[model samples]
Target: MIPTPEIRHVNVTRYITPLREGGSLPAVADADDGFKYVVKFKGAGHGVKMLIAELIGCEIGRVLGFKVPEVVFAHLDEAFGRTEADEEIQDLLKGSQGLNIGLHFLSGAINFDPVVTTIDAQLASEIVWFDAFMTNIDRTFRNTNMLMWHRELWLIDHGASLYFHHSFTNWEKGAQTPFALVKDHVLLPQASELDTANQKLKSLLTPQVLQDIVNLIPQEWLEWEGYEQTTEEIRAIYFQFLTARLAQAEVFTKTAQDARKALI
Candidate 1:
């Protein structure tokens, strides 16, 4: 289990708003540390799955040496003195208090846009490869979840990934392509350079490390359709795919490096 972080409380006002495309209520809370943070309510059933996935993903990303937001599980209470709007939304946010999740908000973060500074091809390619291994279909250009903060790319909003686990277990339907998500979704600018990205990914996808990481996720989270056996089988499938992909990544990485050396 990942160590939980300590949450602090302050007597300050918060502004709450509904996100355009997501299911959670996002609120901006003032911190004594003088920074405003974003906290999403975990009361809704839809938000619950997202909260769990984000927590696990952030930790894994950190282990993989990626820059992720400082996150903590928190509780918003009536004692903190909230706004009338917040109170109105409290019903929607009910049961989230004392167990809400907060992200130390990035003050000036911007969403990724291809028209903006281009993400490095090799780096982007690796991200796509990682998504494929995890079967994530939500990071498309139509709803790109990458955030540009301090000139680095940060991933966010993974509520839509691992969606196959939600449906009934009919192997034929499950194995079908177009897996309830568009396969040819727009790629990140660097995604086309898979040969280079695959190389890097191969080096990173060690079997032991991948197994350790996946095992860390709560068994409850892995279980699909409320069945533990199904969840275990699904995890095994991903593990096999990831292992093979890692080997491929190593080959690609070597080829790319050799090509680069030759050019130099």
Candidate 2:
């Protein structure tokens, strides 16, 4: 079994500023650990599910040897919101006066522009396969949520992946559903070694590794209504969905390959 990642907890020292690029209004905050973090609030319009996705997606990326920013659990006190003058910001902080998600701020990181930067075909294929396996739909040409730091690509803003959890009514059936949209992936044309990537990466995501990743999610974040199962049971459901997807990895791999071929 892979070593479980140690998720450090830090207190919000100060609210630096709001990142306005996205609708959720994530912020750059100074934490007690003397580090700046891009904090994703629990009270955002997207709710806690996004936080769950961010944790799981980033963890999965890390396991696959992708450059993902360090994710930590940030603790916010109600007092932190009292100093914010903006009503919206204050409300968000007040509501998120508990555990939240934070990505370690990478200074001097530039947004990855595909037009300006050329990516290695092997790495591109691995990323494509990874995104396809996760059923991530956010990595498109228009808004690639990636950064280039020290000339290496770093993935960010994975709150939109793992969308199956949003509607768990038929999650089992949905697990095996084809990711037909992989054709739209921005990196599809550059993914020239998907079969090799699939063979190498798929072996790393054993059932134990997936379970270890799911276990990292805080219990409070797992609570959801409209599901008959308890919180732990719901967690188990996630494990099942991921394993089931792994079993059908070839289907998604083929979908991506076919999509890439069509684009040629």
Q: Candidates' lDDT values, in order?
A: 0.56, 0.90
**Which candidate should be chosen as best, given TM-score against the real structure?**
2
Query: What's the TM-score of each model vs. the native?
Result: 0.65, 0.97
**Candidate 1 deviates by what RMSD?**
7.0
Candidate 1 regions off by >4 Å? 1-18, 30-35, 77-88, 168-185, 202-264
Model 1, position 134, has a per-residue lDDT of: 45
Which tens-of-lDDT digit does each residue in 33-103 have in candidate 2?
89999999999987898999899999999999999999999999878789789999999999898999999
Least accurate stretch of 10 residues (summed lDDT) in model 2?
Answer: 220-229
Best of the candidates, lDDT: 2
Please provide, for model 1 over 54-162, each residue's C-alpha lDDT reduced to its tens digit, 9 standing for 90 to 100: 6545555555555667766555565543335556466655555545556677778998887776877666666665555445677877778778888888877655554
Residue 248's lDDT in candidate 2: 80
